[model samples]
Target: MQNEINIPIILASVRKIGDAFLKQYKQNTIPQSMDELLKQLEDIDVLCLTSLKKDLTATFFHMPWHIGDEFDTESQKESTIKGDYWLCDAMDGAIQYLQHIPGWTINLAFIRDGKPLFSVIYDPLATEMFWAKEGAGAYMNGKPLMVSKKTDLGVMLSVFEYGHQDKSTNQLNKEIGMTVTRLLDNFGIVRNYGPHGLQLAYVGAGRIDLFIQEDIDTYNWIAGMLIAKESGAEILNADGIPWQWGSESLLVARKSITEKYLEIKSLK
Candidate 1:
C-alpha cells in the first residue's frame, strides 16, 4: 500500500478491534490453552487486518498481503514486502493470560519506512486504551500521557523481570535478581506484575518511574516503544542503542534517571 490512510481512521479501527477482543477476554470466552488463546486473538487480528485492508485498498487502490496477516517466524523472515507493514501482538502477555492474570494487553502498530507511525496498547481489564500518532503525542483514555520527571533512581518504583522461577540457566533472570538486590540497597525495588506491555505503558503514563528487561520479542515491545517515545520517555537497549523495532533488550525511564542508571551500570 501507499500509506494514504488518515491517522484518525487508523486509530478508530484499532479501537474497534481492541474493544471487540476485550469483550471476549472479559466474557471469558477464549479458551485457556496457548494455542487456543492465540487462535482467538488471531481472529481479532483478522478483523483489524480486514479493516485496514478495506480502507487502504478502497482509498489507495493497493494492499500488501505481507502485512495483511500474522504469520510464524519463518514466514515473517521470508516475507516479500519490505516496507510499510502492520505489526500486532494480539495477546501481549500470553503467560499472564494463561494463568488468569490481569496485566495482559492488546498491542497494534503500523510501521512505515522502518519506524512506528501509529500504535495502541489496550488493557481490557482496566478499560484503558493508550495510543499515539507520530509527532502528535500519546494519550490514555482521552487524556495525554507523559513520562515521569523524576530524576532520582532512589525512591523510584522500577519494574524488572518477573516470573522467572529458574535462576540456574536463565542469564537474564539471574541478572534481574542481582539488579533487584542492588536497587533495594539503593532505596528502590523491582515490582513485577508480569506484563512488559503494561509496564511500558505504565512508564509512559507516569504510573511507574522505570522499566528494564534483558530479552523481549518485537511484538511485545513495538507498540510500547511508540507509546513510551510519544509520551516523552527515554528508551534504550542493554547495549545503549536507541530502542527500535528489532531490539532484544529494553530500558525505559525518564531521561535523567536513564543516564544515571547507565552510568552506574558502566561502573560494574
Candidate 2:
C-alpha cells in the first residue's frame, strides 16, 4: 500500500498550496486587535480550504476526506469511521499566522483503518517538508529523519499545547498547568512553538526531545504522529498505553527517555 502511493505528486500538491498560502501570509499585516485577528483567521481558513479541498479532491478523487473545521464538538463525539481517508488541517497554526508568527504549517495524512499510512507536513515559511510512509521511515526535505537519542530528562527540550481554550474545563486546565510545571522543573527547556504538527515534526527531526498535550484532536495528531513514529519516537497515551485515534492525551517522546517521561507524568 505504501509503495503504491505517489509521493512526489502528493508533495508537489501540498507544496503548491503552501507556497500560495505563504505568499498571502507575507502580504498581510500583523493583526492589531482581537477582532482583526479573528477576522484574519476566518479569511485564512477560507483561503486554505478553497484551494486545498478543490486540489486534493481532484488529485485523489476516490478517497474520502475530512478537514479540521468539520471536526466540531458534535462530530468529535462520534466514533471514527473505519476506512481510508485524507485527513488535513489547512491552517494548522491559524493563531500564529494571524499574529504574523512563523510557526504555522499545512498538515496532511492518509489514514487507513484509523492508522496513518502516509503523511506530510509543510512549513511554507521555512520551505521544509516533512513526510513519512508506514514502513519507509520519516524525512525532511528528502533526508531521513530520526528522533533524538537523548536519555537524560534533565537536559532534554520538551514542548506541549493545552488544547482548545473554548472547550477547556477547569480540570483540564489544572492538569495542563501541573504537567507544564513538572516538565519545567525537570527539562532543560520547555516551551510551546504553536502548531501541533510542527512540534511533532520537530521531535521527528530531533529538534525537541518530547511533546505532550491534553485533549488533542485527530487532525492535530495523525500526520505528525506518523512522522514521529517513523523517526523512531514512541507514541503513547499519558498513561503509557499505545496511542489510538480517540486518545484524550498524547505523548510523543524519544525512545531512550520515554519510560522516564512516563514516570514523571505519573507523579502525584
Candidate 3:
C-alpha cells in the first residue's frame, strides 16, 4: 500500500452576534443575525473537514499584500506587514467598530500544509456568508450557490479585490484586464468588493457571473473555491488550465453559459 499523509486539524468556536461585517445575503431574514449560522461553520471546519485542514487561525488582518506587491514567496518577507495578534487586537480596536460591539471581522484561517484549508467571509452588514472546503466544495450559509449563466462578454458581470486597481500593470493584471476588456468591449460589467471571500461567494451564488484575482493565496481560495464548486461554477486558469493553490487563478462558469455569453458578446 502507498504511504498516506494524515493531516491533523484544529478549530475554535467564534460567535458573532447582531450586525457584523457580512457581504450580502440572498434574502432578508428576521433577527438578521448570523450568530447561529456561524456557530455551525465552527464545527464544519474542524469536525467534518479537519482531515484536510490544519494549523488554522483567524483574524481581522492577516497578510499584508499591496497593489504592486507580488504574491510570490518574496511577499512573505515584508516585516512591515503586521502579524496575527496585532490584527486581532486591531479588529477589536477602539477606533474601529469593534470598540462598540466587540465583534466584527474578516474570518481567516490556514490548514496544516500552509494553504487556506477553509475559510468564511461573514459580512453581517450585507448578511452574506461565504464558506468553503479545499477540494470537496464551497457554500454560503447551507444554501447551494453558483455563478450567473450570463457569460457573454457584453452581458457578464465581474468581481475583483482592492490591490488590482492600485497595482502596477503586472502580468496578473494584464491577463485579467485583457479578459475584462474583451468582455466589456461588448458591455460586460466589472465590480470590485474588496474581499475575496465575498467575491467568490457572489460568483457561486450566481449573483454575478465572473470573479478573477491574481493573488490566489490559501486564505482566499480555501473557502471560496469550495463554494464555487458546490455552486456549479468552474475553477481554472483563464487560458483553459486547471486551478491550483500558489498560482495564478481564474474562475469560469459552465461551458453552456460561457459559450452563450461568448456568442452573444461576439468576441473574435
The numbered model that scores best in TM-score is 2
| TM per prediction | 0.77, 0.90, 0.54
**What C-alpha lDDT do the candidate models reach, one value each?**
0.68, 0.81, 0.45
210: Cα error in model 2, Å: 0.5
Q: Candidates ranked by TM-score, best first?
A: 2, 1, 3
lDDT of 2 at 202: 91
User: Per-residue alpha-carbon lDDT of model 1 for 1-268, expressed as tens digits?
Assistant: 3675475665665566656655655455548577887776566556656765665455435434333222332332232445777676655675465455577776777777767678888776787888888888989988999998876666788877543233366586767666676556653655876767778888899988878776654456668778888899888986577876545567888788787777777776
Any idea how many clashes model 3 has?
21
lDDT of 2 by residue, 162-261 (tens): 6653453457777788889988988999998888888998999999999998665657877899999999999988778898766778889876677887
For model 3, the run of ten residues with the poorest summed lDDT: 86-95
CA RMSD per model (angstroms): 4.2, 2.5, 11.1
Model 2 reaches what TM-score against the true structure? 0.90
Candidate 3 Cα errors over 4 Å, as ranges: 1-105, 109-117, 134-137, 151-154, 161-176, 214-218, 257-268
Score residue 114 of candidate 3 by CA lDDT: 37
Instruction: Give the C-alpha lDDT of model 2.
Output: 0.81
Instruction: Please provide, for model 3 over 137-173, each residue's C-alpha lDDT reduced to its tens digit, 9 standing for 90 to 100.
Output: 5566556565676635566676654232334545666
The residue ranges of model 1 lying beyond 4 angstroms of the native Cα positions read 26-81, 162-170
